[model samples]
Target: MKIFVARLQGTPVFDPAGDQIGRIRDVVVGLRLGHRPNVHGFVVEVQPRRRVFLPITRVRRIEAGAVIFTGRINMRRFEQRTTETLAIGEILDLTVRFDDQPMTVYDVAMEETRPSTWEITSVALYKGRRREPRIVDWGEVSGFDTLQKDQGAAGLIAAFESLRAADMASALHDLPSKRRIEIARALNDTRLADVLEELPPDDQIGILGTLEPERAADVLEEMGPDDAADLLHDLPEEQASELLALMEPGEAAPVRRLLTYPEDSAGGVMTSEPVILPPSATVAEALAHIRQQDLTPSVAAQVYVSRPPTETPTGTYLGVSHFQRLLREPPSTQLGTVLDPSIDPIRPQFTLLQVAYYLANYNLVAAPVVDELGRLVGAVTVDDVLDHMLPEDWRERADYRDE
Candidate 1:
């Protein structure tokens, strides 16, 4: 039961039967539940396994030869032993106890012998023991200014952030296309897509070309359809077709239709992914429907409020209403009242030149696309028309044209 304040590192630990355990590498404490916490447990770096956790209660004391603890404990009992082969979820849930307080271990680093790599590891809880921290119920950790004099951890982190921001594009540019694609695939799709935005079109296309079709499709899936279509249009036709084939047919089908339209036209500029709600749908029902759908804010704008399918075709369109407009109105208000009569929609057959003129004339980000039957099929944005009217890199080529 007695505890002593000793340097955690290099402290020899022993089991209940007096068998040698391992010296302490670091002790993880659980403060997971706010204040009133305790020691999670000591993470011991040992031979054969490299790292394992022992409960604080099982330990007898800090006073003697090697940290002494209750005997008969074996490496098999420690979750760290299986870490080399365990899945990430398994390792995260494994718990360890420190000084009788409960806490979970996380982000454990492990060594892979088969593949020869360092793996980060974690633990959940100790069997039958409470957990505690090395320093219990500790307040905010300060003293960063004192540590910064020697350029400690904080300095290193700041340096890394600076380096990443300063050289992200350069680093990506220098990387082989395959390696760049590998890095991109390793990142969250949204994060990778954001980085792709910063790169030049040529580099973006190069990196995407190097990726497996499915991975490339995943990244593109995160992009706005207009942006995704634009990126696809830049790829070689065969490569573009192959990557599109890799995507879910429903998701890719609309992109393919957009491709058929001249890039400058309303149909080409619009994403086919608009959120459609039956005209009879209540404000509350529409809100719920929008929540369940994965359409983007731009797509949500052209939410085609339509009549019920069973209803005979009405000559009238329920019209598009902005989300903000919906929020301002009572939930009971019918969408028919919110219908914006002033807006003019484009026919699917409109030429790219005609769509551009409408965009330039209206100064609008989006316009509706309707079929011959007067049913809304898609919506286009100004950017889509502009991208086609003025080809990407047109500014750079302007000099040659003038010459």
Candidate 2:
């Protein structure tokens, strides 16, 4: 038999003696891969504000608006296990994107594959009265299991794996602190680092506080130096020092450099990992480096050529080479021949407004930063600039738009 989750809610359950036992409050299921979860049990409201668990094995028949069971139902209150998922409470009425179009989930249809085991097969989506409601296969949707507060931390993490870090962070922000910490614990270092960078300062500090010092240090190492520095700046000085001490010296060094500048300064917002090559490097070598790092569009759009035996914090800044210019030149052509020395580098102490103006005036996606000795230090991307320019509560507003 097939039934919709919405219909199952509020339906009455009858005992073997044909006497009313309770009304169905929720249906519990366990999450699995590829296929829908198997129905585990039913949460039955025995009295006002009181609920009990009725195992699926005890159910004899599921009739219209009612359920018939053969055994005695336990009167003990339902205690949700970590593996259980409550369909009505967690899934139904949630927003999901189907075929890239936003819609609200009105109901979920479950199919009985065997005598008692059932799995969710499809979801009913509704946009508005002007459009006909659509039913889509369960696999064709995203954002269904997001914000599932009661599911186990591992299950919640798996459900959100496809989401971008920004989207995942927004979902995590809406959950209760305990559940949020649980989910944070389940994420790997790289994924956690990305999400942490997208979160607000208070949330970043709160989540980091939950992790062990060693794990927190590893996550900080995985983040962009500027972002890692910003997070550390908000922590107690002693605690921040401890985390830095736990990190690898090489990774920690860049973050330490960023911390020396004021929070609103160019050095504070610039990433220390931009592509830096010697002026003698060939166009092919620069292209290979960009491909190997898999840098983002803004960061990969240009390369800084400096006098170097060492590239990072290069010995001396020569100039910049735009990716477009590199592509136009012969593969073996030296970078020094193509360097754009006319573009001035911003100083570390430059304010946010000055950095923005520099980038805007040059029509560049990123602008290089240099120290007093004229050695290249870092590059500030447009995204980082916008992050500082936006209102403090922008992330909260972004979450609302997703719903």
lDDT scores of the candidates, listed in order: 0.54, 0.81
Error of 2 at 182 (Å): 1.1
| lDDT value, residue 15 of candidate 2 | 90
After superposing candidate 2 on the true structure, give the runs of residues whose Cα lies further than 4 Å from its correct spot.
1-151, 398-403
lDDT of 2 by residue, 75-132 (tens): 7656778877777656654668999987777667788888877788888877744335
**Poorly placed runs, candidate 1 (over 4 Å):** 1-182, 194-199, 285-302, 308-317, 351-353, 359-363, 394-403
Model 1, 58-115: lDDT tens digits are 6556664477866444453234331122222122222334445544332232222222
Best by lDDT: 2
For each of the candidates, the C-alpha root-mean-square deviation to the true structure, in angstroms, is 19.4, 16.6
lDDT of 1 at 394: 44
lDDT of 1: 0.54
